[model samples]
Target: MAKKLWVERNEDGSWDAYSDDGAHIKFGHGKGLFNPGDLMKVALAGCAALSSQFPIENALGEGKGARITVDGDYDEATDGYTAFREQVVVDAQSAGIHGDDAEKLKDRVERHIEKSCTVKHTYEVATPVTMKVKVITK
Candidate 1:
């Protein structure tokens, strides 16, 4: 199924983004709202976490999960992000998987995320974005 997503500006100048599934997020250049860059980082982190969920749960149990953090470095000269670092932390040792087992689990999770995370794959490929503008006149 094709997904539809859009953002509408509010009277207060902030924007509300909505998806076809009813997911909503408030974002703009305002306090207590996520900026565009922050959303991108969040998307990457969420995708990675989801992509590795099955491997992590299979190794550590059903309720076990990983914490994924994505940080992007903004370059003022280019007015864009220069790099993004993602960290996925899973406490396999606490689940009794130790030493070589933990390392193997980590490697497996990384490989799974690298292969399955759509957002991460997009970032690596540098997808091109095209915009179309509509002008309305009274």
Candidate 2:
């Protein structure tokens, strides 16, 4: 299925981006909304977080004290992300995951970080994007 989005330019110069699922967002400088580039950061960060979730849960199970977070640091000059800092804060005493298990956890998480996330792969490698333009007049 192909998903579509529609964007409208407001009278005040800010723009509203609408999704196919009745979702709307405003974006522009000083518009207090996320610009398109910022949204890319969001996608990368969110993908990283989601990609890491499974490994953490699989290692420790779905219980208390298994918190996973991924924050992407964006490089403004390069117009891309410089780093994605991941924090997997688990309470060792509560979760009963310790010793060699802890050692193995890092490996599992790292394996998934770069390999699993689709968006991260797209950003890392050169994926050609081509566009064609046509003008329609009434």
Candidate 3:
């Protein structure tokens, strides 16, 4: 079973997520090139790439490796929403993978990402959320 991860940020500006077994990731809000939200999209893309690996390999038996990349396009002017597009390129010399296989793999990856990715799933649903802030003078 996968370990449950718990994430926290300290007052000193450090961040980390710990699992039951102590495995975790360390990073801060401003420490990376992009924020945690951006990393969420990257993780979705990474999941797509990794999930498609098996299909690609099976389609290209004893074939050369191929590179698959997923990109997300956002429209901030329209309420900060984004669409994800995946690009997959296969080597011509590869033994099993072909144009058709690549197309099928792309579709499979798309469906998987839409349904399985945490960020994507969250974005697809509408949740009732509200925020309240109180200011105190000392």
Candidate 4:
């Protein structure tokens, strides 16, 4: 389903990609672009954040503030990533999603993000990919 995502690197040494659904993302080592490792975080964390949107809203109602953070310690030599640590910080006191209700809502929100976020699920079950390198000699 994600094969539609395409990548391009410019002469300026910046990377850019297009998502299957038409999102344009830029990557680089400097400025506002996302570096390679940060991109991984963005993919997983962004998916989680987006996936949690509905649940957060449902629990706290519309227009409430909820922050989701996801981090993975990646080892490049092995291309292996450690378990992701996630934190969902909700402004319970201000938003009214406090006490027992907030705790249950937070638990449900985490579960929903883990279950429904595609990127997170994919990483949970790693897969082997077959690749072919093509050298174009035009």
- The lDDT for every candidate, in the order shown, is 0.91, 0.73, 0.62, 0.78
Candidate 1 lDDT score at position 76? 92
List residue ranges in candidate 4 displaced over 4 A. 1-3
Candidate 3, poorest ten consecutive residues by summed lDDT:
57-66
TM-score per candidate: 0.92, 0.65, 0.55, 0.83
For model 3, how does the per-residue alpha-carbon lDDT over 33-105 read when each residue is reduced to its tens digit? 3456566666766665555555556666544334656566677687454676656565545455457865776
RMSD of each: 1.4, 4.0, 5.3, 2.2
Among the numbered candidates, top lDDT falls to 1
Instruction: Please give the lDDT score for candidate 4.
Output: 0.78
lDDT of 2 by residue, 1-138 (tens): 766888899998889989898988888767587777677766776776677777877766764334555567778899876776556555555567788987788778768877888887887787798989899999
Which tens-of-lDDT digit does each residue in 1-82 have in candidate 4?
A: 4458878989999988887787898888889878877877778877877777887777667876467677788877888777
Give per-residue lDDT, candidate 3, residue 116: 55
Which pairs clash in the backbone of model 4?
none
Better of 1 and 3 by TM-score: 1
Candidate 1 residue-wise lDDT, 1-138, digit = tens: 779999999999999999999999999987898899999999999998889999999998897899988898999999999889999999887689988988889899999998999988888887899999999999
Shift of residue 41 alpha carbon in model 3, Å: 0.8
Report lDDT (Cα) of residue 109, candidate 2: 76
lDDT value, candidate 1, whole model? 0.91
Ranking 1 against 2 by TM-score, winner: 1
* Candidates sorted by lDDT, best first: 1, 4, 2, 3
